[model samples]
Every structure is written in structure tokens, then in C-alpha cells.
Target chain A: MAGTNGTIISVNKVRKSYYRDTIEIPVLNNISINVPEGEFLALMGPSGSGKTTLLNLIAGIDRPDEGEVVVGGVNIAALSESELSKWRARHVGFVFQFYNLLPVLTAYENVELPLLLTNLSKKEKHEHVEFALKLVGLSDRMYNKPGQLSGGQEQRVAIARAVVTDPTILVADEPTGDLDKVSAAEIMELLDRLNKEYKKTIVMVTHDPRAAEKAHTVRHLEKGELT
Target chain B: MKIPLKYTFRNLQSRRLTTALTILGITLVVFVFAAVLMMAHGVEKTLVATGSEENILISRKASNGEISSIIDGETVNIILAMNQVARTPAGAPFATKDVATVINLPKTDYVGITNVTVRGVSPDAFALRPMVKIVEGRAFQWGAREIIIGNSIARRILNARVGGTIKIGGDQWTIVGRFDAEGCGFDSEIWGDVLQLTDALGRSNAFSTLTLKLRSPQEFDSFKEAFESDARLQQFVPKTERQFFEEQSETMALFIRVLGIFITVIFSAGAVIGAMITMYGAVANRTVEIGTLRALGFRRRSVLSAYLIESLMIALIGGIVGVVLASFLQFFSISTINFDSFAEIEFSFALSTGIIISSLMFAVVMGFVGGFLPAFRAARLNIVSALRAS
Candidate 1:
């Protein structure tokens, strides 16, 4: 539930597991966390430490096996698949490790994707796409396809797509994991500016210490438990 | 909301080789399907065009074709005296006693021999069939060893041209004229003097068939009833010319249709399987893209419909191209031996609106059947695993 004190996400005793050939492998064991409004939180751990699993749960793309995930006062774990999809479209912006922009679409068209789910007019969608691309410093590269852009530029376009709908929370899974040092620093700076100036709440999973340093709060997980 | 159609089209364009190959398979199948239907329609049209509504043909009872029927001179006289028979404006009956038979003829261009219909008819034969027009030279002289070959026979048979001579039954017959019968079955026959042909062929004063024009088309029922009731005429049967020819085409047309359906079914199965393979490859290649669209708020049904639309586009394109190719076949003619008459008849392929609609509908059905399972597999993919695909 939404705590009266401005907590936007509350995960209470969530447990998740995966199954392979009739055997259950635990990924998260009775985890609990809270992210306040406008808080930039980072989850850091070794590979297979359930960091991305927790982020996915908070984003409402996956459900916890045992407990409730309440975001913006709604128990997302109890929502149906269709309702959760709509909620994610309206409230959560997602950026992936590989910058999963549709390669067939131009940068401008990719940025305009999230708005296609909304009731916005074409003019409004154009305005939103232009503003999002400009905010990510890719206004000049809007007509380029993903294959034509560098890795960092493609990620910037992905970020533009994610924030075009003005989601309440942005969840990023290793946003700079596939980038060079220069591109990584630029992405971290963009995330910092979004959190500090725009007051956008962000949950990030990163193995890099430099990327975690930009967050206001950093949590570490070890062997499926918060350490 | 459904995914945009442009996205589906762009994906097809990206896989150009697979799309083109699958479309080609569908095109070949549709072409064969349409060609079969056009062939059957052509046979029916050609045979039906040979008969007139106001004419009645008299053949011996239990005979399948005119070649096997025999009518004596006395019975021919009885039929000519009937009041139902039409007059030829000079107080003469519009009746012809014709003898029909087949002779082997060598092909002009090829070394093989084929059966050609030879008809022996009186002078009144031309009056009964107005569609037959003499295009070269004059009609054969009565009681002379002369013949007028149809234009089709003149073109294909050796030494059957106008002013040429063909040896038949130990006698030389001069070819006097060539006629066109408006693309009907009569265009494949040779006509000559009935008495001379019967005497030369040793038929012993008997004609093979009697054709007479009725006063009106509606007078056929009474004429048939009266002819059947007469004890002398009981050995013969009367049938309206149109109905007789229509019945003659049924067996051959049915054979062609059944054979066509069989071949089409087999080819369509292969084509459908090919389409399924192509669609499966598409799904496998675009797993990540489908998951991306799902994550962006598109429903599973939208994914299904998008794939279906792509498959339909391929089939429709193939269908249109196949129909266009089949339409060109109407300009060419083919010859086949009629099962009942055992004589060659020439006809062309015919295309109709009904054939086009049916062929297109069959292609669509194949597309639907081939694409459904693959689209279902795409929709059933788990979002978690799909997004994780490389």
C-alpha cells in the first residue's frame, strides 16, 4: 500500500522462484524493500543474485510468488495480465541492457511508440516525441535507424521511447552494461539529470560501481537475500 | 490495440527470399486450379454450342452416338411426313438423313494418325445448322465423290485442303469446300453426299441418323410423344438437339472436373505445407520483436492477426497473378476424343467470373489453414522467455 509518508513502491515479503524439470530454484527469498517518490535507487549484486528479478517485480512485468507488490496504492501482484500490461503502459518506463529498440523503426518513430498506446492526437504525439528526443540530446539523429546509430545513441533513443509517456517510475536493467566507458558515463549523467532535475523516480540494476554511485540509495543482494 | 499493418509489411520485406518463394508456390497451385476449371467450362461451352433449340435428332433406340445408330429409308420417310416438321419455304421438309462414321487421318505437322468424324448428309443438312458457314469454295455436289471438310480438319489433316483429294473406301473423293462452324463440335467433321457414302461404305440402304427442324421449340414434347407411340417408329428415339449435346458433354466434363479436383487437392496440400514452414521461420526469427510489441501494450490477439494478415497478403498476390496467367489460355485450342462419339473435337479454354472467385477463395482458404498454427505459436510465447531470446 502507499504509505502516508510518500513511499511510492512497497514490496512486502516477496518470494519468487523458477522451475526447471519439476524442480523449483529460488531466486528471491522473502525480500522486502520500499522506494520513496523521486528516489533514485540502485540494486547491485553478482550475476544471478535476484537483482533484476526484484526490479522486474517492481515494474509489474513479473509477479512475486508469495507476497504483494504495491505501487501507487494498487496491489499490482493481484492484477491480471491484461490489466498489468495497461498499468505498465501508463506508469512504468523500461530500459533494457541491450537497448531493445525496434530496429525497423527510425529514431523518431521509436520514441513515438509508447504514445501509440495513449489517446493522444497525432500533433500531440509529435510534440511529445520531439521533446523526448530533444531531452535525450538526440534531436538531430531522430531520422536514423538503430543500425545506423552507435550503441550509445541507440540507448538514448530507447530512453526517449521509455519516457515519452511520462511514466511515474523508470526501471532500467543494467543500462550501461553493453556500453563503452565514455558512453556509460554519459548515460549515468543523463540518469542523474533525470532524477535530480526532473524528479523522476528510478530503479536501476547495475554491476558497475560507477553506475551505482549516481543513485541516492544503493542496495546489495547476495545469494537471493538482501545483504 | 492491434499492431500497425505497416510493421507487418516491413517485416515481410525484410525476408524477401522466403516471401517470394512462398508466393511462388501459391501461384503455381492457383494456376493449375484455375486452368482445370477453365478447361471444363470450355468443353461444356463448345459442346452446347453445337445444337439448336428448335431441332430434334432421331437415333436408333439404345444407341449412344449417331455413329452407331441406323435408320431405314422407310422410317426416314415417316418422320418427314409428320406435321410437327418445319417447312423450307418451297414446300419441302427441313429434314436430313445423315450417316456418321470415323476415319483415320494422318496429321499434317506430326507423323501420328488421329480419328476424324466423317458425316454423310443430304442437301438439306446445311439448312438445319445455320451456324455452319462455307468459308472456302462451294458445297459438295450431290451424288458425286466430293466432300467439304470443316476448317479444323482442313488445317490439321494431311491432304484434306480445298481442291485436294483423299482416298476413302477404295475411292478418291475430291475436297470441294471448307466451312467454319463457329467453334462447335461440327467444326471437326467432314461432310459428303449421303447416298454415295452409304453405297461406298456398304451400309445397305440405311442412314445412321435423322435430324429435322421442328415447327417451334415447344413442339418437341408432343412430337416426341407421337413418335414414341407409333409402332413403326418405336425402334427410334427423339431428343431435342440441345439436350442431346448437353448430355454428351456430361461424362467428359465430369471426368475432367474430378481429375482436376484431385490434382489441385494434392498441390494445395504441398503449397499449404510450404506456407507453414515459411511462417514458422518468420515466427522463430521475430520472437524478440513479438515480445517487444507485447511489452509495449499490444495484446496477444493483435500479434495473431498481424501474422495472419501477412500470410493473406502473400496468398492474394499469388492468386491474382495465377488468374492473369490462366486468362491468356483462352486464345489456344485443344483437341480430345469424345468418349461417346470416339471422334476428335476441338475446343478452347474458357474463363468466367465464377472461376476467378472460386480460385481466389481457394487460395485464401489455403492461406488461413497454413498460417493459423504458426500464429498461435507466436501468441503463446511467454513474455519472460521471449524477451530473453537473442
Candidate 2:
């Protein structure tokens, strides 16, 4: 499936459904989207709008019933579970609203996690972790555990972890959903900076209008289709 | 850190109550395992370890222990001239004619007769077993009624210590001292002058056996050849020290070993089951965490390994604890009736490295057996369902 020269992710007429014994319920209705290099796209919808379903499909965490999902020049829809996992590790960085930092690990160790999948030496891993923490402006708090940090600071560490490997794209599912108003604003501002300063591609799913305002473009997901 | 070490610590730390309870269960199981092994060891150490390879007891044909054997004093002198006999400094063969008898002696705690062996010896008998030494008092007079008891007899029985009076059959004898042969089977015996016991019991012409020290273990064949070929005492048979003890322990050892296995198998089964429950609970408690690891790019094998490691640590802790506590059983002496001689013999616990290693290996196996299914369950988790669980 050839696309534009600079396209980073290509989804062609993706249709996904879930089976309940004898019945199949469609979640996405012939969805099609493309995110090129350095794009900042937002997926917006209210509750039950299939926004999360489409995000999961695009992220390669799940496959569409019948369609193509190509990211970073690889079709994840055709990959096996293990192959997809390796592909996700090297190509995709995911940030969840709960800021899923391993509670036992410090901020530094949390950001160092994804790099473990890489074959980097210990010294190289340390450099990558330090650089990622510094990028999120949390270098001073790297030794602090998630419980010791504020909600906003924990989210920043999550962002650092997502981008620690320098992947082609960052995907966030309601990145600011759990934070207070000020902390939510801080997280959105960090994502905007990641887009403009580092030329990072970001795909975000959000219910908050304020969060989507920071994205370069927004798509509304309703009833099984993106409008 | 590796996934196994990482999750093992996390699982133990996260469920403090369950972890402590599981460890306690394992400890109890291990304790029983160790205690039974100690009892079996005690029985063996009392008998087998006491015999010296170079010594032989010339008992009668078909006679087992000394209580069933008797040879005249004249026969003892005839066996001393054999070429394979070890010589004293004066070039006389290192041999002594003696009387060995088992008596009903009272223990400090048990009211029944604890069999205390009393050996009536000549002066040369001391040299025959150089390992024995008078630790508390002097040896008995050559013809006096004074007696000396072994260390274990003196410490474990009543009225048997140094300067105490003990009655054997109908005769009263004074315990002049306590002696030791390095806490071997000899430590539960009494020694007196042979002529006194012979004269008092009216068996003056008879002795239990002629004790001889051979030059080495290899000289047993020559020793047997010289003794058995003598036309004068054609029935006299020579036995190596180890062979003699082996004959004594043969029946009893098998009985004890079977008993040990029976007891251990019961406790080991309970322990293995207890470990299984704890490991399953561990998997149930950490299902979400396992799912999260799967979502984070860890392979199923790594997750399984992590759970197995955690179980092994717990089982190993319990096993080591059992062994340490079992070592203390060395101090406890048990009185078992020797069916061959019908005398209650005393035994002390003996620990061997084989027992410890076997116990540790058994614990590890229990960990592996108990932890498998749960680990498989953790590894097979669907990452989405698990992350969405709680």
C-alpha cells in the first residue's frame, strides 16, 4: 500500500468489529486516516463514541476486522502478536491518562523502562533516561517515586517514558483526563512543546475541548465514524 | 533486575499477611522433615560409626551380639599368635580377652531399663581401641569391682556418673569414672575388670570374645585364614571391625530407613500442597501486574520465570530453616531397643550433608511443582483484559 512520500501512518478503509458468540458488533465503520511525519492530530468524541476503539486500532494494540494499519512503513495488521510487540516497542510510544508508571520504580527507572527492550548497554541506557527526563523538565525529580510526585509531575514522567526511545510517534489516550485543571493545562502545554520543538508526531484522544485546542488538527469520532 | 527477581520481591512485599502465613506453613513442614531424619541418623551414628576397621571380635558361630556368644579363656590365648595380628611394643599381639554384657540400667527420664553395655576387659583392651580415653575418672582395677561408664551412659542415665553406685544384676559396683571414644557407639557402655565379672557370675572359664587389632583393613583375609585354619579351634571365625558393625546394623538400619522415608513422604506431601496454594494465591493477587508487564513488551517466558523464582525463594527459606532446627536435634539422645540383643540402646542424632542437600532439593522441587500452573496462567493473560481488570 503506497502512500504519500512523507506519510508516517496510513490506515486504509479500516473496519473493526467484536464478536459476541454468534453476533459481530462493528466498532469502526470503514475508517480511513493518515498521519504524516511531525503531525499533531486529535481524536475527539464524547463517551461511547468509539474513539478509544479507533485509537487502539491505530496504535496496533488491536487489529481491525478487515483493513490495513501501516505505521512507520510496516503493516501491523499483518504482524503476529510477538512481532507487533517488538514493532510497538521500537515505533510507538503510548501515554495513558492514569500515567501508568510502575509504582515501585522511581521517575528515572520509570523512564528507563522502554529502553530495556533495546539492546543498549547500561551506559547508553543511563544517557537516554537522563536525556528523556531533562526533556520533560523533571531532571531534578528523577529519583522520586510516583507516589512522591504530584499528579502533573507523574504525567510528565509518563510522557518522558513514552518518548524515551525517540519513536516516530506518540499516542495518548486522554493524557490529561485524571489531572486537576492546572496540571491538565501543564500536560497539554508539554505535548504542544513536544510537537513544535522536537518535531514529534502525536495522536491524542480527548473529551476535553481545551486539550484538543492545542492539537494542530482535530477529528470528531461519533457513532462508529470519524467526522 | 530480571523479571523473576523483580516480581518475586514485589509479590512477597505486596501481600505481607499471605506471604508470612505461607512461609510459616513451609517452616512447619520442613521442621517435621528434619526431625525424622535426625532420629534416623541418631540410630545409625550410635551403631555404625563406633566400629574401627582394624579391630575384630572373635564371637562364636551363629552368635550375633556379645549377649549370645561365649568362648573359654583358653581359646582366647590360642588366637593371639596369628601372623596377621598387630603387635604391641613388646612384640606380643595386641589382643585382649573380655566379657561384654547388656544390663537393664535406668535413664534419667525413662523409668524402664535402658540397655547399658558393660565390657569386662584386661589391661590390653585399652590399647585395642586407642580412641577411648578416661575423661572423668580412672579405669577399673584389674581385679576390683570398680567400673567406669561411657560418656553417653554417664550423662544420660541415673546413678551412672563418676563416683556413683550402680547395681548390675545382684552385685553393687562403684562408677570410678567416665570415659569417651569420641562420642561413638562406645559412649553408651560400661567397662570393668573381666575376672571380677567372671568370678562373681560363676562363669570363670568362659569369656565373651578375644578382641584383636589387625594391622590394617586389607589384612582381614590373612587374619581370617590364620584363625579359621587352626585345627585346635576349627570353629573360630575372624571378622573385620566394619563387617561386625554392619552385621549388627543390617536389620535395624533397613527398618529405620523405611521408617524415615514413610514419615518424610507424608510431611513432604503436605508441604508441597501448602506451597501450591500459596503460589496460586500469588498469581491471583498479581494478575493485573502480569498483564501490565505483557503490555510493556515482556515475553510470556519472562513472566513465568519471575513467578517460579519467587516460589523457589520462599521454599528455600523454609528448607534452610528446617535444617538449622534439625541440627539442634543432635543434642537429644533416644533409647531404642536393639531387637538383635533385646537391649535398649541409646542413640544420638547425627547430621549428614546428604540429608541437607536432599531436603533443599526437595523444597525446590515443591516450588517448581506448585508454581507451574499459576505461572502459566500469568503468562497466558490477555494484555487488554488484564489491564482492564482493575
Candidate 3:
């Protein structure tokens, strides 16, 4: 961690559940964690461990049934649905396991999607997108669509999309889960560069211990509790 | 932030067949709607164009049409003597005693028989209607058994050419000329000398109606009041020529309008359902795309508006195509029976700016109604679950 040692994300007594008809299945129970700015923290858990659910709460994609999630000083759990969306745009950037880049959009356009929310002019937005794509070493593939790129290139493009707006934090769930060993190593190297060189705050959830080993700090969740 | 319009456009383009079929459905509905409106307007235009605002028509009381009305010589003389009646610069009253009757004629295409109006008019009738211009051959002589056919009638009926003779009431009346009446109901009639026609048809002592020009259009109400109040003429009804033609067109135009609306309502239901099905399919197919958009911080309203605009664009494309197709109808003329007179009248399809605007507006309404539920469903999708869906 290179930046100021200040808390960027604070989770307190957060509880979450899922419903199957009339039955309530508990997912995350009273989870609490504090993530400092510029730290690359990895979350490792097996199946049905509530790892993705806890990541979603921290990213403002979902609200916990109990307690509060404060990211970048905003109480996201207390905000309205619309307010939560706007907060997420300015504060959190997400990378999914599926590399959720729209197939119809080119690499440049997919990275430019988050910048559309800003009041930047087209010229200015183009410059920002170019810089972000260059950071992921895919500057030459800017015009190529997601379908035309390999699995590793697609995940790199997704990373470029997440950081294009220079949000306060980046939350990625299973960023390298679908990649082969070589591609997974390359993705981890890029994530390491983002933390060490750019001082970006990243909280990633992963199933591969090799991928988690690259992070500065590793936390494990077992059966909805920290272990 | 909302997704750009190009995104929505490209999405529709991605599903070409569904988009095309939905558009075709709307096009059919709009085509039916615009064509019916044109039909009704054409009927009104043909009849209303036949009369001038400054003229008055005198007919027997309770008569529905000039063909069913009779005016005696005394009534014609009294109407001619009124001070409100205009006179020609040559000091003759601008009035004529006209005879109206229907004659059955064979269609040129051998499609069966149709009723054509035969009107007998005095010399003053030509001066009263300046729009009637002879396009071929010379005018008929005063005492000769000669007739002039209107251009439409000459074109539609067999043996109606200039210089041909047709047997009417056991007498061979020669066609002397063809005249154009500026696209009015008179364009479907044959004109001849009033005295000769009365003698041939054996209605020697009475005329069908008296048509006279008023000194000014403002004098019509006073003229009607005077004729109605006079005990000598109390058995007759006097109406402005415009009013009489309007009444003549009302029944036919209303019928066309009602029938057109009924058909349009039925077709629009099918079109709306088609649009709904297309939109619902779009939502179902693009669930992950929508979730990704929501994940990018686009509001629910933005997603809803994007889909609505897409549907509206489809409807507009269909509406434009329908209007273009309906416009070609203006080139062909159609004939139908005038309900009031029970006489055949010829008219061409007419298109107006109001009709185009209203048709497009109606298509938009259908699109909005069809796309609303599907768009709402898209907006209400749960981000977590939607992202997990393939």
C-alpha cells in the first residue's frame, strides 16, 4: 500500500439473506471489515461462502438487511436506490467473473461507458479512455470488440472499463477465475501493477489461491464468517 | 446517465427479423387508417365542390334530392322575380329551371351497369357555372336533340364519346361535346336542353328544381326566409347551394368514417400486440445487457426511456411507409353511389396534411401503449439476479 493509511471502506454488522419461496437462507451474518486506501485485498472462499454477496455489499450493488456499509464516507445502505446508483458511479468500479463487457461495444467504447456519466466533452472523454486502455497494455486493441479478443484480453478490457472513470475504489469478483494458468498469471501481474504503481484501492473476491497470493493482504471467509 | 440513442438503434438492428415484422404490422394498420380517411374526404370533396356559396336551390318540400323534387312554372317565375336574385350583365335573371333523372348505362370495362345522372338545363345554366368548360367538340344547339357528356362520364361509360348518339327515352340524342366540371359530382352527368328533355321524358309541365344565384352570399338567409314565408311558395324549400350539397354528402361520408374507424380499431389491436411481443422478446433476450447497463449506474428511468424510444422509432418508420403507399391512390378514380340521391358519383382519393399527421400520431400512441409494460418490466429487474442470468 502506497497512499495514505486511511480507511476507504467500512462494513459494520452487515447481515444478508436469500429467499426460496417462504424460506429465508442466511448468506452473510454480521460481517465487519475496514479496507484502507491503496491496499490490494483479496477475499478467498469456497462455494456458498457468501464471498460474492459480501463483495456486492461493499460495492453498493446491494444493501444489507442489517447494519451499514460506508464507502468513501457515504452510508450506502441509508441511500435511496437511485442515490445508491449515483454513488456507485462516482465511488465504486466493479469487474465481474464473466468479464461483463457488452459484446456489441468495442474495447474503447466499453471503457468509455462509465465516463458518459461525467460532464466531460467528447474529446476529453476520448483522452481518458485512451489513457485507461494504455494502462492495461491493450492500446492497440482499442477498436476490437470483446468477441474478437481472447479471454485474458477481455478481462483486461473489463479492468480498463472499471478504472476508466478513476473511481475511489475498485471491487472485482473472480477476476481471473475463467482464465487458464498463463492468462491468470498475466491478470494477476496487471492487478499487482495497478496497486503498486497507480496506488489504486482494490478489493477482489477470488476462488484461486494462486490469484489471492498476489494481493498485499488476503482474507478468507468460510460459511458466511471470517476465518 | 442514459444509454446513447445509437445503442438502442443498434440493438433493434441486431434483431432484424423481429423488428421488421413488428414494423410491418404497424404499417398495415396505418395504411388501413389513412386510406379510409382519404375515402371519406374524397366523398366530401366531390359533393361540396359541386355548389357555390352564393347560389340558392329551390325544391319541393320534404324532397331528399333534386331528382325527387318538382317545381312548377309559377314557382320558377316567382323565384326568378325576387329582387335578391342576381341578374346577368345582359339584364337576364341568372336562374335556370333544371331537370334531374338517372339513366342506366353500361360500363366501358363491361363490369356491369351503373346509374349516370342526366341533367337538362336552360341556356343560363352555363353562365351560372363558369367552371364547366368544354374540353372537346362544340356546344349543343338550342332546339336539337344533342347532349354534352361530362369528362368523367365520357371516360367511364360505353358509347359516351363526342359525336356518338345514345338512345334516351326512345330518342337518339347525339353527344356533342365533353365538358370538365372541376372535379365535382356534375362530372358524372349528361347535360341537354331542358325543353327537349321534358318533351322526350314526358314531364312537360314541371322541372326537377330551380337553381338561382343570389345577389350576394349574405342574401341567402333572407332569400330562404322570404321564400319560406310566402304563401304562394310555402310548399317549397329554399336552401343555400352549399348547405344542400353538404346534406347530400353527410350520409355517405359518415358511413365511410364509421366503417373506417371500425376496421382500424380491429387492426390496431393486432398491431399493438405484435409490438408488445417484440419488445418483450427484446427484454428477455437482453437481460444481461440491461443488468450491465444498470450496473454501470444508468437509472431505471433511463432504461425505460431507451426502450420506449426504440419502439417509437419502429412505429414512425411504419407510419411513413403507410402514408407513402396511400399516396399512390390519388392516381386512380373510384365511383360509388351517393346515398342521398342514389346516383353514381365519381371521385379520386384525396390526401391532406391533417391525415398524415394524425396517422403518425395514432401509430405513436399504439407504440407507446405496446412498449410500456415491457419497458416497465425491464426497469424493475433486480440487478443481482439479472447479472447472473445469461
Per-model TM-score, in order, reads 0.90, 0.87, 0.93
Displacement of residue B336 (Cα, Å) in model 3 is: 1.2
True contacts kept of each: 0.29, 0.12, 0.39
- Per-residue lDDT of model 3, residues B1-390, tens digit only: 778887788777878999999999999999989999898889888888888776788888878998999998877888889889999899888988899998888889778888888999999888777788899998888888999999889988997999898778889999999999999988999999999999999999699988899888888778878877888998898877777887888999899989998989889999999999999998998898888888878889988998888888888888888888988888878989888888889998889999899889989998998899999999999988888896
Please tell me which predicted candidate would have the highest DockQ against the true structure. Answer: 3
Candidate 2 scores a chain A TM-score of 0.96
Higher lDDT: candidate 1 or 2? 1
Every candidate's DockQ is: 0.49, 0.31, 0.60
True-structure lDDT of candidate 2: 0.79
lDDT of candidate 3 over A1-227, digit per residue (tens):
22235888888999999999989999999899988988899999898999999998888878899999888777889999998878877877888888998877789989999899888999999999999999999999999989899999999999999988888888889999899999999989998998888888999999899999989899999889888
RMSD of each: 3.0, 3.6, 2.6
On residues B84-185, what C-alpha lDDT tens digit does candidate 1 reach at each position?
999888988898899998988898878988888899998888888988899999999998999999978988888889999877778889999999999998
- Tens digits of per-residue lDDT for model 2, A142-205: 9998899999999999999999998878899899999999999999999999999999899999
Candidate 1 ranges with C-alpha deviation above 4 Å: A1-5, A193-199, B53-61, B69-84, B167-170, B204-212, B218-240
